[model samples]
Structures are given as C-alpha cells and as structure tokens.
Target: MAQQVNPPRGMRDFLPAQKLKRERALAIIREVYAAHGFDEIETPVIEDYARLHAGLGGDNEKLSFSILKRGLRQEQLENAVVTGTGDVLCDLGLRFDLTVPLARYYASNRADLPATFRAVHIGPVWRAERPQKGRYRQFVQADIDIIGEPGLLAEAELITATSAALARLGLAGCVIRINDRRLLAALLDYCGFNAADSDRVLITIDKLDKIGVQGVIDELRGFGAEFVTPAVKLEHILNSYSEAACAGDIALTESGIAAVLPADLAPEVTSALISLGEMVAPGLPAGVRLAFDPTLVRGMGYYTGTIFEIAHPGSGSSVGGGGRYDGMIGRFLSQSVPAVGFSIGFERIIDLIDLPPAADQRAVALIADKAVDPAVLLRIKAELIASGARVQIATRTKNVRPLLDRFELDGFTEFANVRPEHTSMHDLDFKVFAES
Candidate 1:
C-alpha cells in the first residue's frame, strides 16, 4: 500500500504553470509598490495567539488553525474535547493575514522606521477553512501599508496605488466600492441604534451578498424591536443609492441619505466623501470606477474609518478590499499609529485571468541524440548559456514530444537539438504566427 500523496485539503501544490502565474503576478505587484516608494518587509508566518485573537480578523478569526501547545502535558491532549471549548489547547497559530503581523512588526521596530513608512508585504497566510473549488486554506496576499500618516491622505494614497497596480495587471474600470465605518456608525445612530450595536449589525450586513435582504431583516430582529427600524430604513437608503449610482449621481444620492441622517453627522459624512472623491478623481486612469455606497460594510472588526472593496461582478465576491485601521496598532503599543492598506487577492486574480509569464530571456531547450558526444553537448550548452538563453538539456526518453511539451509548459519558446553527424546545432522558435 502507498501513503496518500495529496496536499492537505483546502491547500494547493502549484506546478510549473500555477507557480509561474503567481510569481509573475507578485512581481508586477511589487514593481508597482516600488515605483510608489514602498520598501519591502518580511514577517514570520507563525504569530502569537494573542495577536491573532485580538478582535481584528472579523470572520477570519473563526477560521484560524491553531497549533497545539508544544511539550504539552500528554494528559491535556487525551482529556481535550474535540469541539467548541477545544480552542483552549492551542498556544500559537499561523497568521490569518499579513496585517496583524505587520502591526506587531511596526510596534516592535517603530523607533527605527521612517515617520511615514510605506511597507510592502507579500506572503502566504493560512485558514482552517472547508475546501472549495476556488477557495483555499493557504493563499498568497500582497499588501501595502502606510503607517503614521494621520490624514485621509493615507487612504487616498493606498487606493490610488492599488488601483494603479490592478490597472497595470489589466483590471481596468473595476468598481472600487468605498464607505466609512464612521458612516455606518452615523447611519445606525440616525436610525436610533446605539454605537455598541454597530459591530453586530455590520457583521450581518456584510453577509447581504450571501444571505439576501430578508435574511438580514431576520438577523437584525435578534437585536430587539428598536433594531428592526434600522434594518428597514437601511434597505431604502441603499436602494436609493443603487438607483442613483447607475445614473452617475453619487453626490445627489448621498445628499438624499443626508436628509435622514443626524444634522451634524450628515454634513460630516457628505463632506468627507465628497472631498475623498475630488482628491482621487482627477488623476485616476480610465476604467477604474469609484463609487460611494452607503451599504459597503466590510466585515473586518478592526476597520475604524473608511472601508473599501474591489468589485468584480463575474465573481459573487470582491476580489480585494481594505480599510483604515488606525487603531489596530494601538492595541499593540497603546498609542495611535495611523495606517491604511489594500490587498489584491493573488489567488482570485490568478483564477480570473491569464498572467503573462515573468520576462524570459529567449529561452531554448536543447535535446541531444544519444550518440552525440558528451564533450560536444557540454560545449553547446555552454555557448547557449553565454548567448543569454536559458538552456535545458533534455533527457533520453521513449518519445521526445512529451519532454518538449513539458519544457514548453515551463516557458521555453524555442527548441534546439543536435543531430548526429551534423556539423551545426539547429534551433526552432516553435511559435506559430498567422499570415499577416
């Protein structure tokens, strides 16, 4: 009997093509971040349970995979129940995403970092999730964060850089839905709901795409009679925005919501959004659409200010989203280090489109006849390497086409083979071009 060789469920094993696409995507992302003056940083995959458990991950906290206490009393493992209260057994966990670890990193090294640090992070994060076709337990996220910039400028910068990167990767005119948790707070306040109920309401509202409108009404009823009004009113507000959003009347639509909101809160909300729009609108490239949606409630618990998500109708979910979490790092060091960021879903984008391979230096695969001289083969390989071609010497096999297919799949655009008794090596570009 052979041992099972599959990767763990909800995880993946990337072969040549899969690996190449991800790597090239990462490169394009990093290049964009670099051009904007962000420096790269690395953080450990495993973080203290306290950091991950800090009430910031939203629903992701529920999906974390905890590592059992090392050197544990064997008795503990034996006595532990396998459900619910079972979480007490773990001392550490793989990070759920790059942000929390970045928070910890900044707190640890803030003294030496720049006053306004634009940090780039690219890495894999894990979740103990149920496996699905496109969903995975392990996936890569590319993130950029600007720390210590207290103004709304940070949010504007993050949005601009991310929109540019996605555009560079061919995501033009993607709708970037924007909202502020402050706006959510104000809306709930106007409906006569308390600030404390905001988080619970947001958690339910975030599910609108999955659970439908009636489901949200049912869930809000759990909060008590007063909660029901906010739910009903919110429907009307977002419905109004949707109708007007199609006509490019964002300002007018928001003004309508302003009518029902608190006098002070309404003006603040309307002014901030209008200003943000003006700042981001002028230089933005065509095809990148920005919208002001009253209903955009990002699920993350740490978002304290503006919130955003990338919209792609093809997938029922946003491919990327982020928000201002100026308070997330304060939990680490007990002082505000204002920050904002955006993460493009590396895996989701890979699924949505073809990524051009990383730049190839005109690579050629060399296949030699068995009778060809070992000395001659070495010379051919050396000369090809010198001429800037990544040369691979194909192994002797029953059929050479399979080997050729394998090499071609790895991004070799041409093939070279030495013929026995031939005076010179032959090269073929192996590409088909239609008649012009």
Candidate 2:
C-alpha cells in the first residue's frame, strides 16, 4: 500500500489559478489601505509563549499552537508532568492573530516610528481548534491599526478605510454594526447583573443572533434565580427597541440613542457613539450603512472602548470586526497609548467575491513543435518576453485542445504555434484564446 499524501488537516494548498485570484484581491486591499495613508509593516510568525498567553488575546490564547522547547531531557518532561505544569515545556507559540504581534512590534520600535503611527499588516495566523465549513486552523488576516490616537477620530478613520477596501473589492451592502464596551457594561449594570459575571454574560449575549432573545433569557435563568428578573427585563427592553426601530422611530442621533436605552445610562458613552456615527457616514461608499447595535459584544476581552463588526447581507456570519484596545500597547510599553484597529476576514470575503485576472500583464503561451530547434525556441521566448509579454514554452502534444484549455485556465491570454523555420517574433502568429 502507498502512503497517503495530503496537506495537514484544517490547512490547504492553492492551485495556480486560485493563488492568482487571492493575490489580485489582496493587491486591491493593499492599494486601498496605502492610499488612506497607512504604511505596511511585518512581524515574526512566532512569539514568546508568555507574551502569547498574556491574556490580551482573549479566548484565542487557548487556541494558539505552542512550540516545544528544543533539547529537552527526559527528566525535565517527567518533572513537568509531576508538577502538572505542562505549559512550561514550551518556550514559543505560533501567533493566533496579527494584533498581538503588532503591539509587540510597536513596543520594540516606538522610538524610530512616527509619533502617531498608522500601520497595515497582512499575514497568516494559526489556531489549534476543530475545523468546519469556512473555519480553518490557519488563515490570513488583513489588519489596519492606528496607534497614539485617543479620540473618536481613530474609530472613524479605521471604519472608513476598511469600508473603502471592501468597496474597492466590489462588495456591496456592507453594514458596520458599532457599539462601545462602556455602553455594554452600562447596559449590564442597568439590568442588575453582578460586575464579576459580566464577561460570561456578555459572551452569551454575543450569541443573540445565533440564539433568540428568549433563548438568552432561558440561559441567564440557568445561572441563578437572581438572573431571571433582570434577563426578563432585558428581553422587554430589547423587544421594545426592535419595535421602535421597525416603526422608524429611532435614529443614530443623540436624542434617538437616548430614547432607546435606559435613562440612567452614562451620557458620555452614548454621546461618543453618536459622534462616531456622524463622522463615519460621510466617508462611506454608496449603499454601505453604519448602525448602532447594542447587543454587539465582540468576543475579545481586550476591547476597551468602541467595538464593531462588519455584516453583509450575503454572509451568514460577520465578514470582519475589530475594536479599540487602548490598554494593549500599555502592557508592553509601560505607559498608556491609545490604539484601535479593524481586520478584514480575508478567507470569508474571498469566497464571497469573484474577480477577473489582473489585466496589466499580458501572458502568452508558446506552443512549439518537437521538430523545432532548441535554439529557435529559446530565441522566440526571449523575443516575446523582451516585448513585455509573459511567455511560456510548451511542446506540442498529441492533442492540442487540452493543452490550450489548460493554458487558458492558467491565465494565458494568447497562444502561438512555433515551427523550425520561425526565427524572429514577427514570424510567429499569435491568436487570442477567445478567438481560437
């Protein structure tokens, strides 16, 4: 029996056509981001184990793939097992997301960078979780972060730049659902939930889309008798707001925001949210929307202020999300530096879009007969290439139809049949595949 050959589970290999498509889409994203004044940066794929597990990554920390320490003796392994400290066996881990590595990079090079840094980082990250449809153990993330900005301008800029990237990709009907962490905490407080249980409760509420309002109430009831009344009141409040929104009574204005929530909630959070909505509206492309979603609890624990997710009518899940992690950089820099970012779900959006091959370079397939001299083939190829066309030499096969079809699939725009007598570019006649 032969051994099976395949890529590792939850990972993938891309064919030439697939790779081209992905590259084209990524080029558009990069160009759009650069035009918005964000400079590109890169970091190592692996980081110190302690930094990866430093609680800034939220639940993603648990999903990181740890790298075992080199040259470990048997006695060290035995001791680790005996002490129940298996994590000590590893010294580094594959980064599970780009944000953590960016924070580390900024901390290490703060002196050389600008006072206010706008960075674009696009790279692959890994996780050790069960894979399913549209989910993988390894994937690419396209992230844009603004560091050293503490005002709503950072949030507005992030949202605008991300929207422009999506728009440039020809994706329409994207709605950026926005909310502040402070507002979520205020809502939980208003509902009478204990402060310590807020994280767990928020995790459940983040599932409101997956589970209905009644489902959330039932789950909260299971926590304890104390959660029952508050959960019920929460259901009532949500239902009333839903009805008002349906009736067109609510808007993104300050008074409209106030009308929807409890009167006792802090005015500062609501004011900030309203200001963000106003700031981002003028910059968005046509047909893209910006709306406030009170139940929008991003799963990351590091988010300190505004948090948001991109929702599209065509996607069953969020296509992208991010938030203001004002405290993340401070953990490494030893001082507070406000920051915010937005990441595009590259894998998900790639599936949603179909892009044509890049048109800037012309690709030509040179089909040569076996009788043609090797010198003639080399000269023809060089001449075509010198004329700014990508040329590939293919020996004539028994059947030419399949060869032409394969070349077309590989993004060749035209093909030429070469003979022994042909010695110059003018002797070879090229025919477009579509015409053939």
Candidate 3:
C-alpha cells in the first residue's frame, strides 16, 4: 500500500464550500479597499534574506523561516555552513510579513510609482510560533497603506475605512482601541525618565493585557527605575480611558515607583490627551469605542506616532493592528520617508466570519458503468456541464445509492443523474436531467 500523506501541523486545506465562504469574505475586503482608492498589486513570495531583516526591530529575528540554497558552488556552500548556529542553519528566509517586502519594493522602484502611492496587497505571511485556537504558523494578511500624506487625517482614514470593512464583513460590534506612543513618551519624560528607560517602560506596559496590571507594575519595580509616581497615579492613568471625563483628582498619588514623576507632568499629559480626544471622538461609529490607553505599547519598535488595535470581544486575540511606521522606509531609501499603514489578519477574519466546515460532495456524479460507450459518456458530461453542475464521471462500478448517500452525508441538497436513458444519447433534455 502507498503511504498515507498529510499536511504539516498548523496548516489547513480549504475545500469547495469553505473556499467559497473565504472568497465571499475577500470580496468584501477588496471592495472596501478599492472603494477607498487603493490599487491592488502583487509581489513575490521570496526575497533577499538581508533586506528582510535590515529594519525589523525587536526579537523578531527568531521568527524567520530561513531557506537553504541548494544550487551553490563549493565556496558558497562553505560560507553557508559557517553561518549555521547550533543545529539551525541560516541563509534565506520565507518573507515573515508583507510590509517589509513592500518597503524594499518601493525603494527599488520609487521612480515609476506615484508620489502618493495607495496600495492594497492581500497575501500569505509565515511565522513560526506555537499554535493555539485561531493561531496558525502560516496565514494571510490583507494590507492597505498610503504614503506621502503625513497628516493625522490619513490615520483617521485608516480607522474609518477599516471600521467600514469590518462592518461589511458582518463583524459590526468590534472595538478599535487607539493610543499614541508620543503621548506615552511625553508622559514618561514628564515623569523624569530618559528616552532609553521610556522604551523599556512602554515595552513592559505593552504586556498589560497578557499579564495583569500588577504584573506590569511588578516588572517595572524589578527593573530598578527610580520611583517616579505613586501607585494611585499609575492606576488612574491606566484607568482614565474608562471614565467619562478627565479630572485633576488623578494627580494625587505617592507610592512605590510612582513618586518619580514631576509635579508639572500631569497638565502636559492632560493637554495632549485633550488634543487626541478631539481628533478621535467625533468620527467614531456606533457600536465602536475608541479610547486613549497608556498601556498600548505596540511591539513593533518602528511606530512613531498614533498606534491602535481592533479587537472583538470573546475573540481569542486582536483582529488586526497598524500604526505610524514613519521610519521603516527610511532604512531602504537612505533618507527618511514617513509611512503609516495597517494589516488585516486574513485568517482571523475567516475564523471570525462563522463559516461552516467544507464537506465532500459531488453535485452531479456520472454513475454509469465502465462499459458505457465513450460517445454517450461525452454527451452526458457536456449536458451536465452546460447546466452548471460540477460533473464527475468516475468508472468505479459503485452503486448509485452509495454515491448519493455520500453526497447526502456531506450537506449537498441538489444532486443530478447525468447518465443517459437506456444507453441512448439521442435528444435528451439536459434541463430535465438537471431538475431531476
């Protein structure tokens, strides 16, 4: 017997019904993207390994799927072997995410592209991570980005357009949480911490969702930073988003690691909060809530301005997130170019859309015997094909009832017998055959 085959763990195969549902979801996303004036473009799945890792900050180096080159000369193989660390070899890697490749593409071909390049790219991205419910090693990302427009309006447009996309996908009651790293930076500065410590503080606070509020505070204390603000002050700052209005009472606090903030920092933080409030408050849609969170330190080190994430309550994780990465393109351009965009985790959208599992079924099966004449078989197939049924002519000599039973088991309501009457192909109505 031949060996049984199976897909690698954490990978999935979408059958006809499931594929149809995914197509419907993609149609909604593409329609929304086109309606917003983003032109679609495709890129290659493979890229230079050096360009992939040049600007990606943080600990993401571990996530790369390094590819081995097989067509290398003796010297090239030696160089590749030298680079191997422990049991792992490194040379080329699967593109981790689409954004990095886009940055490289724009830099290499900026001359032919428009000044304000609005693009919609939807494709697969690979990450080697522990899989859980709704998380996969390989998945798809649908991204929309606009460059050469630096105003906050671009950010607002991303929020509005993404909200529209979700609504169209029947995911109406989603929450888009908004925050500003600059505001957090200013708050840190007001607390008398330097830039280096601020990065650490923001990174630590970013994990508040995973680890509770106290865990973040304890981690900060473990870092041995000077006590800048009281515990009450910290809690108030974190909890202020839930309140109706900001008040001065949030300023009174003196406790562990909280006393380090200067007295004048409160008014400055409050003023910045007021400015952001005016920008995001008026445009928010119904069933969506936008709030300023000090703890929303997006893991990407590139984000310079406003950062936000949209999450559906009871969903396993955030549906999608993107923000100002004004410096990523600068890495390739050798001169600073400001850019900001967001990516929709396509696999997550498919999961959240509530699609039924794809079941195996044949809408129209040719149950005729192998002894059936070739000319007669061709006529029946042509007739069924014209009727829009997926016709399959198999010579397995299986009983008709068994085939129909399998079709019924797989949720197919409509089935057609494409076999001709009395072994004659003479002038049979395919319409009647399809109806039957």
Candidate 4:
C-alpha cells in the first residue's frame, strides 16, 4: 500500500480551475482599487518576533506561527524550556494580519513614499488557528490603507474604495457597519465599567453576535461582581433597540445614533460617524448601505477612531472589515502619523462572487489525432496564436468528450479537431463548448 500524502492541515492546494477563478477575482479587486488611487505595496511574510508580539495584533498575536532561531545553542534551548516560553527560541514569526505589516512598511519607507500614501496590498497571511468551516490557518487579505492623513477624508476614501471593490465583484446587499473605539469607550464609561477592564469587556461584547445578549451579560457577570451592574446596564441599552441592534439596522444619522445610547456620551464620535456616512453616500453604488452598529466592537485593540465591518446577506460572518489605527505607525516611527485602512476578506468574498466569464472569447483547445503529423498540429496552433486566440494542443483519445470537458474546465472556450488533412487553421472546424 502507498502512503497517503496531502497538504498540511488547515491549508489547501488549488487546482487549475480553482486557481484561475481566484486570480480573476483578485485582478478585479486590483483594478478597482487602482482606479480609486490606491497604490499597491508588499511586505515580507516573516517579521521580527518582537514586532509580531508587540501587543498590537490583539487575539491574533496568540495565533501567529513563530520560526525557531537558526543554529540555536543547547543552552538557549534549555533556557527556553526552563522558562516555559517560546520567545527565547524564536526570532521571527509569520504575520497574522496585513495591517501590522503595513504599519511597519510605512515607517520604514516614509522618506520615499508620498506624504499621504494610499496603499493597496493583496497577499497571504498565516495564523495558527484551529481550522473550521470558514476559517483557515493560511488565507489571503486585500487591504487599502491611507497613511499620514489625520482627518475624516482618509476614512472616507478607504470606505469608498472598499465598497467599490465589493460592488465591482457583484456582491450586492453589503452593509458597512460603522462604529468608533471612542464611542465604545464612552459607552463603557456610561455603563460604569472600570477603565482598566474596558478591553476585556469589549472582547465579551464582541461576542454578542455569537452569544445572545444574555450570554454576553452572563460572561461579563462571571468576570466579577463589579462587572454585573455595567453588564446589566449595557444589556438594558441593547435590549431597548431589540432586534434592531442585532440586525445592525440602526440609522447613521446623529439622531439615530443618539436614540440608543446615553445622552452626551461621545457626541463628537456620533457627529464624526454621521459626517462619514454623508461623505461616502454619494459615492457608493445602489444596494450598498452604511449603518451604525454601537455593538460593533472590532476585536483589534489598535483602532483609535472609526472601525467598520462589511456584512453580506449570504455570509454568517463579516465578509470584510478595517478601521482607523492612528497610533500603530507611531509605534514604529517614534512619531505620530495618523492612518486609516479597510481590508476586504478575500477568502470570504471569493466564495460569494461568481466572476463574469473571461472577456477573451478566443481561447482554443486544438485536439489532434494521434495519427496527425506533429508538424501539421504545430503549424495550425501557431496560425491560431497569430490570429489572437490562445491555443493548447492535446492528443485525441478514444472518447474525445472527456478530453473536451477537461479543456473547458481549464478555461478553453472552443475546441478544434485536427487531422493529417487539416493543414491550416482554416481547415479545422471549431465548436464552442456548452456552458457548464
């Protein structure tokens, strides 16, 4: 018996058809982003271990895959074991997300880059997560970030470009759920949660979609008696909105945001969100909406201002998301530089969109009989190529149906049967493959 081999767990191998589909979708994303004035950039897959664990990636830091130091001393190994820490043994790690790498990239290349750099990055990131249906240890993220701009204009551009990409991909009914870390902080303050425990409380609140309102309250109550009152207050406010909070149907207007929260709590945050909505409203396509979701606490701790996630009716989870992380680049540059970014969840969106047929209708599969002269087949293929058609030569089989099906699966639109008598491209009759 032969031993079975496969790709590593939580990863995958794409077949020819699958790879073509993914690339076509990615090209559409790149085209849309470039038209929106975002320049594409790339970064190394691995970064210094210290930087990967710099307390910037939130929960994703724990899932980062670390690389062991090369040629480590036995003493170093023992020390790491005795200390029960991998930090001493690892010097680098695979990135868990693109935003952190983007921050580092901007900080390193600032002198050469535009003062207000608008970047588009599409690449793979690795995590050590337990694999699930929609989750993978390795996945791709498409991100557009604007650095060095401090105002709402950066946020507006990110939202506009991201939404346009989704619309171009034919993903309809996408709702951009907006919020702010400042608003979440104010809500926590109004609910009487201790400032120090805000992050932990927000982590639980982030689970409101997974666990119902009562479930979130229960988890917070378990934190301590001090959390009980705040948890209940939070629940009461959410309950007032009933299904609206869960559905994320709350309006984006100032009055709409105020109707659900404590008076005078982060009025500036509400105002900024309202203005953001109005700024992007005229730019977005029909069927795309922008709404306020006070419960939308994006899990990242680095978001200083606006945060949002893109939701689609077809997916149980957000198809994409990003936010303003003004403080992140400063951590690398030692100087404050305001930045905002939006990331399209590439893996998720690809599953939802069916890219239109390839524009080139000239892909041809030349099926040559085994008895056909090789020279004749090559001549015909060259002629088709010169005429602007993509041509592939395949030997004819007993049943050509299976061969034609394989060609169609590989993106060939038409097939031509070649024989000794077929001396020129015009001598062979070409037939289109039935739509799959």
lDDT of 4 by residue, 1-436 (tens): 9786888888999988789889988999999999999999989999999999999898899999999999999988888898898687899999999999999998889999999999998899999988987899999999999999999999998888888888888999999999899999999999999999999999998998898788989999999999988888898987887468557688888778888878888878788998998899888987788888989999998999999999898999999999999899999877899999999988898889987667775799988888998988888888999999989999988988888888888888888888888899999888888743
Which scores greater on TM-score, model 1 or model 4? 4
TM-score, per-candidate, Cα-based: 0.89, 0.95, 0.77, 0.97
Model 4: how far is 53 from its true place, Å?
0.9
TM-score of candidate 2 on Cα atoms, chains taken together: 0.95
lDDT of 3 by residue, 169-214 (tens): 7776676666667767877665455677776777777777777667
Full ranking by TM-score? 4, 2, 1, 3
Candidate 1: 10-residue stretch with minimal lDDT: 427-436
Q: Write the per-residue lDDT of candidate 2 for residues 1-436, one digit (tens) a residue.
A: 9886888888999988788888989999999999999999999999999999999999999999999899999999999999999998999999999999999999999999998899999999999979888889999999999999999988888999999999988888887878889998999888888899999889988877777777888898999988888888788887767544322235567777877888858789898889888888877898577877777889999999999888887788889999999999999977999999999999999998878756776899999999999998898899889999998999999999999998998888999999888898799899999899
Off by over 4 Å in 2: 241-251, 255-259
Say what the RMSD of model 1 is.
3.2
Who is ahead in TM-score, 1 or 3?
1
Superposed by TM-score, candidate 3 places the C-alpha of residue 314 at a distance from the truth, in angstroms, of 3.3
Clashing pairs in 4: none
